[model samples]
Structure formats: C-alpha cells, structure tokens
Target: MERPRYESPVERAIREAQERGEFDNLPGAGKPLDLGDTSDPMWWVRRLAEREQLDFTGALPPAVALRKEAATFPESLTALRTEESVRAVLEDYNLRVRRDRLRPPDPRMPQLLAPTVDVENLLARWRELRAAAGPPLAEPSAPEPRRRRRWFRRR
Candidate 1:
C-alpha cells in the first residue's frame, strides 16, 4: 500500500506545532496517560468536567441537585459550623426532594436522581467528620494593643 500523497491539515498543524515546541512541557508532559485502551462513553465529558473543576451534577435537573447534596452530605458537613447547621441543610434537602417527588411522573425528572436519604445516618456522618477534623482552633482571647498611635488622633 502506498502512503497518502498529502498529510491532513490537522497533521500538518501538529507537526508545525511540535517543531516550535508548542506541545512541550504540557500539564502531563512526562507522565503516562491515566487512561487504558478500553473506552468509556462519557470519557470526554468526565475529562472536561475534571479539567474545569466543575460539578457535573450542576447541569442536571433539580431532582439531581437534591440527591447529590444528600449523597455528599459528609463532605458538606466540614464546612458547616455546627450540628444544627448540618441538620438544617439536610432538612432543607430532604424537603426539596420530597417536594420534587410529589410531582406526577413527568419527562422533567432526572433518571438517576432518586434520593432515599436517612437523616439519622447523615447526622451520624456529620458527627464523625467533626470528630475526625478535631476541635476548632481557639480564637484570640483579646484584641492586641494598638501597634502605633493613629495619625488622626487629637493631640
């Protein structure tokens, strides 16, 4: 078989870029690919989501939003100030999920977002997360003395 008489435009551009070192020192320059020869249907979507640091669920329907929050409740607990806050967030999420479920079956509902949350379990996880994180840092007991007199102070 004879080689193609002309290289594709994409091939020509890539060759030129390689000559100019444009592809050198890229993010994974010396690293091996994390992928395998096997393929995944959503590979590109997952990769784009990772590179953009985006929540893939954000683009999902409201049903998914409630479910994702319930599923990742432990992660959210770290940012919450108190057990009350965790409960509040979970309660709100539960309420939303119930409300969404109340609606008659429709095309609007997301296929994969069925939330069967256990408030008790969520609360327990929150407690475990708090314990694992250790006690909160102690705040200063008093404000420090003024380092210097204010220029605008009356003489």
Candidate 2:
C-alpha cells in the first residue's frame, strides 16, 4: 500500500488558501501577493513584499502612524473608555496603511490566481511553475495516433 503523505503546516495553509478565493483577481495568477501587519506595519510590509515572487527592494518609510497607534494602546487598560478610543483610532489607521500598500490591481494581472496558503507552499508553487510545466522527460510516450492503426478504425 502506498503511504499517505502527511501535510506540513505550510502545505496545509496553502491548501486552505486554495479553497478560499484569495487569488480570484490578481496579476501573474497572484504570483505576487501583499499582506501587512497592523501590529508591526513596517516589518510586516517588508515581510509581505519579500514573500512575493518578485522582489520589491527599496527604501521604506517608517510606519509612523501605525507606530503611534500601537503605542497608544496600553498593555493594561486603566480605563475602558480610553482603551476603546485608542482601539478605534488604531483600527482605522491600520486599515488605511493596508490599503495604501496593496494599491490598485493591475489590469494585466490574471482574473483567477492560485490561492496562497502558507509562505512555503506559495514559494514552492512559484518555483515549480518557474521551472517549467508538462510531463517529466523520463516518462515514455504512448504510441502516436498514426502508428496505432488498430482494427477499430474511425469512420
């Protein structure tokens, strides 16, 4: 009996991503994906760009707004009202930052893309596609249609 392969966390994530319509509309079949963090906007932005197939290496401004918002939220909330107010501002600011980074999708990009689950699986698929598509070189081909002149001929 053939052994069933156990999926790694990364693989599992990719599978999940595929199920979700995350890549429904993106360029290069979503070859390049962007995701950033409100927790640490600067770091996450860089991380997202790095994970993409294409490299977006350039100088990045500090996420001053995000940093400021993050600082406002105290670890231990002394007052519920203060915490709520800070939370609201932080949420709005983070949303803006994310929107700015994503930008508008390019018209040339693919309408449907392979959903990315985990970083590893996404990279794996990218590498595989990059290598080339089609059957393995070692595999033998079936007889050509012309050579297969069987008793049952097409009318």
Model number with the top TM-score: 1
Over 12-119, each residue of candidate 2 has an lDDT whose tens digit, in order, gives 787778679775776667365544455674876567566675544233233443444344433322232333454554455556666545665447853322121232
Per residue, candidate 1 scores C-alpha lDDT tens digits across 1-155 of 34368999998888789889999888988888876333788887787788898876668677767766666767867887677877887777778887877876666644544576777888898788878889966655897887787878847
Model 2 scores worst on lDDT over the 10 consecutive residues at 110-119
State the TM-score for model 2.
Answer: 0.19
lDDT winner: 1
Clashes of each: 0, 3
Each model's TM-score? Answer: 0.51, 0.19
- What are the root-mean-square deviations of the candidates from the true structure over C-alphas? 6.8, 28.8
- Candidate 1: stretches off by over 4 Å: 1-56, 108-113, 139-155
- Residue 104's C-alpha lDDT in candidate 2? 56
Over 4 Å off in model 2, which ranges? 1-65, 68-80, 104-155
